[model samples]
Target: MTEPKNLEVCGSVMDGIAEKGSALESPSKKQPTEYTVYPVRWVVLFIFVLYSASNSLQWIQYSIIQDAVVKYYGVSSIVVYWTSMVYMITYIPLIFPASWLLDKAGLRVTTIIGAFGTCAGSWLKVFSVPQDMFWLGFTGQTVVAIAQVFILNVPPRLAAVWFGADQVSSACSVGVFGNQLGVAVGFFLPPMLVRAQGTIEEIGADFQLMFYIVAAFTSVLFVLILLFFKAAPPTPPSAAADLGSNLDSNFLQSIKKLLTNRNYVLLLISYGLNVGVFYAISTLLNQLVLTYYPGANEDAGRIGLVIVVAGMTGSVVCGLILDKTHRFKETTLAVYAASVVGMIIFTFTLDCGIIAVVYLSSILLGFFMTGYLPVGFEFASEVTYPEPEGTTSGILNAVVQIFGIVLTLTYEWMLSNISDRWSNLTLCAILALGTVITACIRSDLRRQAAQNKG
Candidate 1:
């Protein structure tokens, strides 16, 4: 047996583990140092995605059964709406701090904190099941909203760390899809559990069951994350990961560097608009449908499910395309264009009372709107390479939160004073603007080339 020597290549430490017959040796002796897929990486990502889903399950739980919650708790519509809006509001102030924590302490610590916060919030909501305890529910929502800042900001970082460059976009898409799927579940589950036209007592009992279901799920995920989630793989997964492992820039410096990226700034604006509109629509879907098509109030959950399911499909497809082509700019522009078209159709058709048109428009709108999320997240990471993924993603999400709050309030005002049609028009206009902004963004490939040349 030989004592293998260590070498540093391209700033990465290659040790004796790369030698032949070593425990870490590749199956092919000829390429002992080549990276191979780590099965545990997928397991960790799966758990995190489930955590992401659980976090979102709580966010829109009340929104799906908005009327029942309002009547059951005797709270006004605005108070119930705040349950979801609070998630956006809390993320604005806390995202930067969460990013800092992720950068300073690494993924394990950051995610456990998120899981614990979510678990505590879920348990709190369980206690709030008593009628007339709307304030307790609100308090629990506030805590969970804060926890979302931790969970939502980590997908891009997770993809970057756990996946090879070839799989980064797809990996991110899957992670994001988990969150979207959770929203879909939230939309569908609440209505099934709590009937729209149920009596106050029945509604209260169903709501309690919903809380218990969500609480039990959250508790299980928290325990799983605590027991099995590792910080990262022992070996770097890809060149990006290898590079990321060596970068030790402070949080302030990371933010400063990201701000200087013009492409990222453009993405921030466009992605923020896209996400803002999605949040607004998600939060108000029931109200929008019921206000216009009184006969369709019962179908609100089905409509929501259709939109999100379409969006989930789009996310996965778009991710695969980006992974294969690495065409961030083109894919983004196309999605934005599709979103504009879909939003225009939705604006025109939603109030027409034509079920088929409404469903079609909703599917298209959801597909393009929600599909753009993972693309934008991955694109931001690509352009801002070597910067902490959490920092770039955190800023992007914080921007989305700010936009979400503004847009949600604006939509609410419009619905009250104007008409649902005008609110839909407002969203369409924003999507069109997002398309224009996306068109102007320099491709990540071009930016990388420029950086390399410089």
Candidate 2:
């Protein structure tokens, strides 16, 4: 018996993915010689990317244009905050059941709900964009938030189902790319489209138009999903896919095992803190930027865009590194430390009132911070191998949402009651603690170890 290696070769990356025949088989008893990798996996992944991107676009759409939402709805900024934070709040409760559906019901079934739910929520918001429709808008937003629970944790599971061992981290990164790209677009587009200046009706009309655009986009993707999607490849992509899921006793049991994992628990804490701070900063980004330079609403949106765009590049780089090196702990720690440094620089430079320096700092901050997202996902799934990726990622994400809610509220409170400097400093301290926690996590690399076993 031996571990798997890609002895078979194909021409291009696409060809390799399309016909990774013998590479699908581990040189051990775990994988059968006859197993094959399918081309349709890319099609499935493509649709999933669009589905998740659309859902995530909604999460930040109202946030980037916070002041506009406040003025348009005749509500408080905190009220506008809920428009974004509701996704986090709603995600915590619903992720468990959604992950269960992913683990039990499989891919096609899970996405069916996510796609339609997103479409329905988008259309609902289109109707709710009037000043008198804030209530309807909130309900519709909550519906979109609920749909996220079905989509958020599917990335890692999707990778495990559709990709080869050599491709897991990279595949997961693409899955994550869809999400961050949507956020990037969300941050960039809203401020350009909607404005706080203008008559209430004019502003409301812009908001309505944006919602309709998202609804139409999601509707098209929904139909495409129905046209083309698959539960899994005809054959498992790797030995893990061939055998791992069969070992999942049940969702409850998977959750129990995940909780017992010391490394994964540390990852949960670190990942939550890292992502939570990003969420906090993202949700009230306008306020943070406005603190130093007032009337820079468009600049704030651009800053958010740059951050996510930088993070997208960082995630791809990180994923490729992981694929080649398989150095999860080293890669994660380096990126995490860089992110902490970036945050510190941004905290001080923010008040400097120099847009260029702030943009530079934001790039550094977003590059590592957002890039850290897929690192945490792949690492968690790696350590908790065979626990079911959906369940592992779901619990991790739930913690992220919990922390997002807490940190956003806390940051908002401190921004209001205390001073901006102190508020920013506090979050920097928490992120440093998270980095320390990451340092303490042992690199058992259990999943890789299992793969290496012969």
Q: Considering every candidate listed, which one attains the maximal lDDT?
A: 2
The per-residue C-alpha lDDT of model 2 at residue 317 equals 93
lDDT of 1 at 404: 94
Native-to-model Cα distance after best TM-score fit, residue 285 in candidate 2, in Å:
0.5
The digit string of per-residue lDDT tens for model 1 on 1-454 reads 2122121122111100110111232333332334544678788889998998998878888886788887788788888888999999999889999998887777889999999999899889888878868788889989988999998878777776666545667788888998988888888888888876878778778878888998999999999999999876655555335434544568898899889889889999999999999899889988888886774655788888888889999999998998677677788899989998988888898767687788888898889888888888877876776677788889999999999999998998898899888878888889889889988887656323422222
Give the per-residue lDDT of model 2 (tens digit) for 1-454: 2233351211001111111121333334454543455677788888998899899988888878888887888888888889889999999989989988877777788899999999999899889876888898888889989999988888887887777777778888989999998898889888988977878878977887788889999999999988898777655665555555445347788889899999999999999999999999999899989878788989999999999999999999998998888888899999999988999998899988688899999999999999999989888877787577788889999999999999999999999999988998998999899999999999867666555441
lDDT of each: 0.78, 0.82
Candidate 2: worst-modelled 10 consecutive residues by lDDT: 9-18
Return the top candidate by TM-score.
Answer: 2
- As a whole number from 0 to 100, the lDDT of residue 65 in candidate 2 is 82
